[model samples]
Target: MKIKVNQESCIGCGACAAIAEDLFELNDDGLSQAKVAEVPEEKKEQATEAMEGCPTGAIVSE
Candidate 1:
């Protein structure tokens, strides 16, 4: 599946990046952004958790 971070809603809490390091990262602006074009097969579950763990619900599946 594909994912993207909603920049407007992100709080730069680093939760998504911390929960799923392979799939998300904190950008230079300190907000989370998807690191890959798609969530890799092995990392899908972790990606989901990261999305769910986002306090502001900024991570979106596309």
Candidate 2:
């Protein structure tokens, strides 16, 4: 599975970071973006939680 973030819909909320700091980050633009770091299978669950935690509904999965 892969996760994608809609940068425009992100509101700079740190929920994703809170849930999975290794998977997502707040860039210099102050919007949430996925980290370049590879996401392991074990981390996918937290990543999904983080995606769901976004109040702006900015996350998509494929």
Task: Give the alpha carbon lDDT tens digit for every residue of 1-62 in model 2.
Answer: 67777988988978898888888888899888888445688998897798778898898777
Q: Where is the poorest 10-residue window by lDDT in model 1?
A: 16-25
Please name the candidate that would achieve the greatest lDDT relative to the true structure: 1
Model 1 residue runs over 4 Å out of place are none
Please list all clashing residue pairs in model 1, or write none if there are none: none
TM-score, structure 2 vs. true: 0.87
lDDT of each: 0.92, 0.82
Q: All candidates' TM-scores?
A: 0.95, 0.87
